[model samples]
Target: MKLLRVGPPGAERPVVLDGTRYLDISGVVSDIGEEFWRTDGVERVQAALAAGTLPEVDVTGLRIGPPIARPGVVLCIGMNYATHAAETGAEPPEHPVMFYKAPNTVVGPNDDVLLPRGSAKADWEVELAVVIGRRARYLESPADALSYIGGYCISNDVSERAFQLETSGGQWSKGKSCETFNPLGPWLVTADEIPDPQALGLRSSVNGEARQDSSTADMVFSVAHLIWQLSQVTVLEPGDVVNTGTPEGVAVSGRFPYLRPGDVMELQIEGLSTQRQRLQSAEQEA
Candidate 1:
């Protein structure tokens, strides 16, 4: 089942998409949060849909919000793709390069990406995001890690290079945590539907020009490996999101130009779905 959150920003209601129509799950389930996915929420919704118990909703009239709400952590893997690492002139690390983005950065799929004040190197990175379903600790192997996954979604890893590298003594989080840095959703596709996350193709374009383009197959650290590695250090809880890193063709990769006001970003991954967002000046925030 493909789950989503629709309506205004703070008042989004749970919804499940069945073909071109939507079913309002708000009456059956509250919100698309940790509690929902941790339990048998997906199964329950599927059963309801199968039993013809879900009410048909008018998704066309509602605004969309990030499919998941209040994620415990926004964990990200840096340079997970070999080509992405090569494009940035970095060597592939033996272990995953991990970082954190505050949950406050999370926003809906179609929301505008703010070009933070004093920011000149605002960039775009299209990535595949993983939503954790169950608690996991010290995962024994890659196979063990796969069992913890709940679903997948499309994510835009908006970045500011100057703050990330030069201003913060090379800490990536400095450029990564700005408000509205993470744009997720449109839908949360169940794991069973995805079959193989690594085989999907992903691409991003800015103002109609292509920037990031690659497949999850190019990842240096596969999804299963990253999960296994992370579980060894920290417990993976329900509703935690993991951004598996972007591919080559990012603005910082030196092959393309950086983003500016009025620039639009469109991204898509197989099975997960597509998302589009326009860029606005930071002045809006002031």
Candidate 2:
């Protein structure tokens, strides 16, 4: 099942995609959030739809917001793709390299991305974002990790290289946590719908020029393994957002120029959905 949130930025209401139409599910759940994930919200919405009780919404000209609302943790795995690591002049890690982007960086799919003040090296990373369905702690094996996931969505893991590498004192979050840096979702496709997350094709482009074009098949660590490994160190909570990492061909490799105001980025993952964001300058400090 595909789920989404619609309306203005902070006032989006929950809805489910049905046969090219969006059905209002707000009456069934407050929002597609922690409460929804905690209470078997997907099943409840499915039952509501099956019973013909939900109303169809006219989504024309409305804004599409992030699929999951107010995620507690925005965890990210760095260099999960081998080629990406090589492009950035690093050896493929022996284990998952993790970092955290503030949850407030999350924004709607088509929202305008702001280039932070004094920024000169903002880049785009298209990644498959995993949404946690339930709490997971110390999972016995990688085979058991899939059950902890709620759904999947597309994430544009936008970053600023200057802050990330030159200024970060070895930390990556400052470069990644800029406002509207993470553009997520046209919709969230439930886990059951995506039988194999590693098989999907994900790519990105700037100003209609192809940039990163690769498949999840190139990932150094599979989704299940990342979940299993993360569970060993941290508790994966419901509604948490995990960006699995981007593939090769980003501007960070120096093959292309960094993002500038007026540049546009388009990201897509087969079977999930597409996202487009135009770059604009954030107000400069006085």
Candidate 3:
């Protein structure tokens, strides 16, 4: 099932994409929140679709908001892509390196990505984000980890190198938590639809020039492993998001210039969806 949120940013209505048309399931369920997914929202929607008759809406010219509501936590894995780490002069991590992006940083997929005030060195990272379907605590192995995943979506992990490296001293969140940094969705392709999460192609481009082109196969710790590993340390609640990290060819490598105001970023994950973000200054947005 391809689930999405459409309409204006804050006033988005949850809907399911059926081919070229979008079904308005708002009458059946509210926002696609934690409670919704945890309580079998997807199945309920499927039942509604099976019944055949339902209200539909035109999404042309409408904004595509993040499919899920503000997640409980936006967990991230750093250097999960071996080649991406190499480009930044970092060694391959033996274990998944975890981090977080403030939940409030999330915004609509095509919304203008803001360049934080006094910022430079803003970069792009096209990543595959995993959304949890249910509560997950200590797990025995990576084997059952797939059961916890609800779906996958396209995510651009926008970063500011100066704040992440120079001014941050050691912490990266300072640079990662800028408002509108995480642009997600077009649709959340449910887990059942994705048989192999580790084999999808993901790529990104800046203003029509290709930047990162790689696959989830390059992840040091695959989605299942990351979920299982994280569960051993903390509780993975429903509606929590996990950014599986990006591939090579980021601006930080010096091969390309950092993102500046007026820059445009396009990102995609195979079989999922694509997103385009136009860069603007904080002042421009104001």
Task: State which candidate has the highest lDDT.
Answer: 2
The deviation in Å at residue 64 for candidate 2 is 0.6
Query: Where does candidate 3 clash, by residue pair?
Result: none
Worst 10 residues of 1 by lDDT: 54-63
Instruction: Give all TM-scores, in the order shown.
Output: 0.98, 0.98, 0.98
lDDT digits (tens) for residues 186-268 of candidate 3: 89999999999999999899999999889899999999999999999889999999999889999999999999999999999
Question: Every model's Cα RMSD, please?
Answer: 1.0, 1.2, 0.8
Per-residue alpha-carbon lDDT of model 2 for 1-286, expressed as tens digits?
A: 9999999999999999998888999999999988999999999998998999889999999999999898999999999999999999999999999999999999999999999988999999999999999999999999999999999999999999999999999999989999999999999999999999999999899999999999999999999999999999999999999999999999999999999989999999999989999999888321
State the RMSD for candidate 1: 1.0
- Residue 32 in candidate 1, Cα distance off native in Å: 0.8
Q: In model 3, which runs have C-alpha deviations exceeding 4 angstroms?
A: none
Compared with the true structure, what per-residue lDDT tens digits does model 1 show for residues 1-286? 8999988888889999999888888877888889997678888888888898888987776678999997999999998988888888999888899999989999999999899888899989899999998998998899988878999999998999999988978678999999999999989998889888889999988888877778999899889999999999888899899999998888887777788888899999988788999998879757
Clashes of 2: 1
